[model samples]
Structure formats: structure tokens, C-alpha cells
Target: MTSPPPHVAVSNYKGGVGKTSLAQGLTVAAAEAGDRVLVIDMDAQGNLTRRLRAPLSPNPDERFGASLADVLQRPAKGEIERILVPCGYGGIYSERISVAPTHFDLELLARTAGQAASERRLLRALAGVTDDFDLVVIDTPPRLFCHLIDIAWTASDVILMPCEGEYEAVEAARRVKERVLEDRHTLNPDLEIAGMVVSRYRSNLTLHKQRAKEMEKIVGAEGICPTRLPELVAFKNMSEKALPIVECGSEGRHMASLYRDVYKWSRDRINTVMKGAA
Candidate 1:
């Protein structure tokens, strides 16, 4: 019997585009829906780590006790539970949600000159662990590096590309799709794009609306999520409080609704992909 593929990864090569926020929202939504979920911080900036209060390090070698870096180096010995930090809301710490914390060491790994077979490190590290959770959403870095490529090609069964509904962002999505196809042909043959999501949308802005239409043309209407997240202050508030929007109170209700849409869309995509594979 074959194991199930991990849920998906929210990734893009552009920074400051709400990648981490989307990851957190999806993880929280899934957990709240009673699915065991794990969020992996794969960026060197460690925004996710800081948000969850995970351990940090000034140097690569001195980071968290167990991290994605450690798992890459020793998959057989590394366990997700060892590195995972539980993020609770209203004093809740259930098995529904966990985070595989990372640190600056990720950048060190990316910069290493002689890192042979590094492209497959993440794949090996995550082996034998997909079955442990209902989903494992990875927050990839904003640049193309060994770690990003490795996770994109090896670990990701589905890719969720988030855009800001701008021409530049749409162009970036095109490039990302091309890269995904290229990687699938060579490394991970089963990889597929789950869909595209428009974040920070403002219907009052003609430019934003036009760009959204253009993006739908590029990725297809069905490939684009129907629920576009409006530009709201609530998201920023969630970030400030270091909590998922769902747990942030009545002010966060809008953000929580957006997360529910994402959770439903992602679940449908995963089910579709699984059915196709079967």
C-alpha cells in the first residue's frame, strides 16, 4: 500500500506577497476543521518561527534543537515531533495543529557551495511522515534556491500560487508554472498546480480588477479561486497578535471566513488530485 501525498505548499518567488500569512491561515483553518496539520517554515527569515515563538539562532549551526535542517541531515533520526512547536488559541493545544520550526540555518544551507545531493534532502527528510497528518503545508522562501527547488520538486504534490492581482505578480505566476512543469518533468513527475489565489484584492481599484481578470486568463477560471480576499486590516492585526485570525475574536471574523474558503478550496483540490492519481 502506498502512502498519501502531503497536502500542499504555498509558494512564490516574490517576497512581501502574503505567503506566510496564507500558510498560517490555511494551517489554522485545517486544524480548526479537525484535520491534523503541520506548517513547515522553510524561509531563512524565520517569520513563521518568530510568530509562533519557536527557538532562533544567530548562526546556522546553533538554531532550533530539531528543524528542517536537522531532518535533512539525518532523516532516520529526525522526528517531526521533536522540532514541532504547538501554537495555541484560547489556551488550546490539541493534536490538530503543529509547526515544524526553522531558522537562519536554512540560509546557510542555501549558501553552501559543495552541498552535493542537496536537491533531494527535503524529500528524504520528509519521507515516512506524510501519513502522520492530514496536511503538511510548507512556507517556502521567496527565491529560487536548493531548498525551494527541492521542496517544489520532491515534496510538493500540489502547489498553491498566491498573487497580489498585479501584472508583475501575474508574470511571476507564469514563470512559476513554467518552473513547476520543468521540475515535474525531471524530478517530481507527479507534481501538479492545485490553483491560484488572489490576495489583497480591492474591487474599487480598476487596476486590481483588471489584473485579476488577466490572471484568470493565464491560469484558467477554474484554476483561480472564486473567493478573493479583500484588503483588510484584520490580517495585519492577526499578525500583530501572533495568532490565527479564527481565534482573534469578532474583529477577525472576516479573516476567518477567508480562511474557511481557502480550506474548502484546498480540500477539493487535494481530493481531485488523489482521485486522478488513483
Candidate 2:
């Protein structure tokens, strides 16, 4: 018997913590590792969707087709799968990563989100297609309050917060944990903080090193990922080009390796939790 695919939400209340970038990298890494991955762009900005559609030059303002907002407004079971846009770029994986792209209308979804019948709208939609993939990565908006974030947390098995080694980043991670705990007690008891990744880390800086150590203590050693992702210009360039950092070029190899290691660690963590539950 096969267990349902794990839903991992790459989330942080703080913006510009490289949250979307990390989400994109992890999805690409998972796909290359032979997991059929689905990226759900829950951000109203649509950065994840735009990056994934890059090189193809999608119009950011236009609603190309059915988007996340559309699904949330009328979340019928299996409707999420119908909006999946195939990533045309093929390299490391035999199967291309698929994304449920979002458009500007998602901003509308965020504004009038309370109109939705249930906070579990996303959970119900995803449940219909759990057997189709090994993993589902949700790129949530950078804010803590909102129905969209609620939906993401409700649907997710593990919430991975990618924090930079900075004071604001650390505080943001703490707030996210508090929010998740609130949701767990009141809404979704199954949700867990699988782990937190210290992203864009600089080894030589005392501040960065100290913050990573502190986060490890807060989340426990196992909850903090071993590999620290370095800051790289290639990440931004790859996003602009609509390509995964791993597929960008030789310059991005090192960064990609770090992200891949984190992805593997996350996979192991989820499997361990699932086994314990079994």
C-alpha cells in the first residue's frame, strides 16, 4: 500500500528571505530525485509561477488560464490537477515538474479570501490528487495572516521555513512557529514543522554562524538542516530566466548542491515521521 504524497509548504512570514527561491530549488531537486513534484504557487505575487514559466516570458499581469484563485473560489475535488502547467524544460528529470500557476488575480483571492466556504478548501482539492505525485510543494505568500496561508497550513504535512541568518529572519521563523502551533491546536493537528533551513548563509560572518546555531537549538538539531545554502547571484539570474538553479549553468552547481542536500534531508525527515505514525 502506498502512503499519500506529503504536502510541504515552504513558508515564512518575512519577505525576501529567499523563500520562493528555496521553494523552487527544492521542487527541482525533488523532481530530479525521482519524485513526481507539484508546485502550488500560493503567493499573490506569483513569483514562483513566473520563475517556473521563465524564458517562455509569460505576461505577469494577464490571467493566462485557470489559476490558484479560480480553484480556491470554487474548490472542487480534482480541480487542482486540471490547472497543472507542465514545465517544458527537461534536463535532470525524466518527468518535468508541474506547477499550478498563479496570476495577479490571486491578489484578489487574498483580499476576499474569507468568502471561501472552508479553510480546508486547498486540502480537499489536493486530497483528490494525492496519489498522482510523491510530493507537493506550496510557495506561500510572505505574510502571516490571510486565508491563503491558512489553506496552505491546513493542507501541509510539513511546513519548512527557510530563514536567513539574521535577526529579522530568526524572529520571523519564531512567529511562523507560533502561528503553526495555533493552527495545530485549533485547525490542523497533523501539521508539523519538519525543519528550518538557514539559507543564503555566509560562513565567515560571526553573526550568520551564531544565528544558525541558535536556530538549531530552537528547532532541535534534527529540525535544522545540516547544509547551509550560500548566497549566489545565480539564483536571481536563474529565476529571471525561468530555469532551475541546477539547470542554469556551471556557476550555479555549488548552490544547487547545497539545496539538493537540504531537499534530501527534508525527505528523510518526512519519511521518519511517516514511519513513526505507521
Candidate 3:
């Protein structure tokens, strides 16, 4: 039997660090590599959901019938499989990638999920689908929703954090380390940081360069990714159109390569760690 797919949570406490961009790119690349991919959009903003055309609704009760909110709030056998909808726009991997889209009610659910059993609810729900995909990428809400973020971290084997090259983003990267330690101690002992990718980088900015160096110190040079995603207009254009970078015009094709490189780098790191464990 094939080994279970790796659950990758592309997370950051700070917003606009290219978290969603990275998640979408990684899932697309994974699918291209012959891995059936599933992207779980845990962010209430539904940015990933909209881009992937997974499913969406402002009304929780109405969307719960086909959104992630239902899987988390009301668990039943086959619920996860039933909610998975295939990608409608990913390049080449459009059919290979699947998504568990989000609903606006996710914000409320995060607030009311209660402390007890908050983390495991997602893990339990995902148990049935572990073998269904080669990779599971979770696009999380930035900062505001801790409970749902915690669930993503708990169920994940590796967390890939995207940090913008700046002081605040660097500080956030440090806090991410602390959160990982806390989770290892109290929640998921197997949880680990796959590595940190410096996104939205501009080569000419001195402060950006300085903070990128600082981030390397925090996660260690080994944990810092070599391929950095440059600040490009293509990202915004692609996002606005609700299309994957790979599917965008030729410019997007070039930009998509950078993101895919990071995914391959991250996948190699995860595989190395899993092999060591075995």
C-alpha cells in the first residue's frame, strides 16, 4: 500500500505573506508530480475557495451542506469524501486536485468550537481521507482564527510558513517556532516545521534583505528555503482572476515555476524527515 499523503499547512500569523499563493501553487505542482492533491481551505475569506472554485457561501447553514464547516461541525462517515470537489481551473492538474472549500461561518465556528476537542476534530475528520490523496494542503486564516489554525497544525505532518522579508514578518517567523514547540509539547508530538519560505521579496530593498537574513537565523540557514518568491504583479493579477499562476498568461507561467521550486524543496525536506523517522 502507498504511504499516507503528507498534510502540509502553509501558515503564517501575519496576513499577505503569500500564504494562499504558496498553498495553491504547491497543490498544483504536487498534482503535476502525479500526486493526487487535496487543498483544504480553512480561511473564512474564501480566497482559496474562490480561486479554486471549490465552493462558497455567505450563509453558513446553506454552505454547510457542501463546505468544510459541515465536516468540522457535524462529523459522519463519508462526510469528508462527500464534500471534496475537484479543481475547475488548476493548469494540467485541474482534474487531479480536489478541495474542501470554506464557508463564512468558519469564523463563527472557530470562535465557538470550544477548547475541548478543538484540535482533534479535524484530525478525526481527515482520518477517512488520508489515503485518498498524495498531499493535503491547508490554506489557513491569518491571525484571527487560532482554533481552526490549531486544528490544521495538529493534523499536519509539516507546517510550511511563508514570511515576507521584513521586520514584522521575521518576528512572526520566530513566534511560529514557539508555536511549533508548544504544539509538540502539548498537542501533536510529531509536528515539525518543514521550513520557511521568504515570499514577496524585492532584491533592491535593504531592509528586506536584512530581515531575510534574520529569518535564516531564527529557523537556521538549513531551514530557510533557497528559492524566494519575488514580488510580482502576476500574483495579484492571477488572484484577482481566480486562476492559478500556471493557468494565467505566459508571465504567470514563469512566476509559477518559482513557487513550484519551493514546493519541491519542501517535499524533499518532508520526505527526508519521514525517512529518518522510519
TM-score against truth, every candidate: 0.89, 0.91, 0.92
Q: Order the candidates by TM-score, highest first.
A: 3, 2, 1
Return the TM-score for candidate 1, rounded to 2 decimals.
Answer: 0.89
Model 1: which residue pairs collide?
Answer: none
Residues 41-124, candidate 1: write the lDDT tens digits. Answer: 878677876665555556646564567666655455235556676664534434566777777666656554356756656666
RMSD of 2: 2.5
**Residue by residue across 34-145, what tens digits does model 2's lDDT show?**
7888889888788888787722235543454467777877678877887777765665443658888876677665556556456788877776686878898999998887
Whole-model lDDT, candidate 2?
0.80
- Residue 39's lDDT in candidate 3: 85
Q: Which runs in model 3 stand beyond 4 Å of their true positions?
A: 57-61, 276-278
* Model with the higher lDDT, candidate 1 or 2: 2
Quote the positional error of residue 99 for candidate 3 in Å.
0.4
Q: Judge candidate 1 against the unseen true structure and give its global Cα lDDT, from 0 to 1.
A: 0.72
Best by lDDT: 2
Candidate 1 segments exceeding 4 Å error: 1-5, 56-64, 88-94, 111-116
Residue 273 miss distance in model 2 (angstroms) = 3.5
Candidate 2 residues lying further than 4 Å off, grouped into runs, are 54-65, 91-94, 111-117, 274-278
Clash pairs, model 2 backbone: none
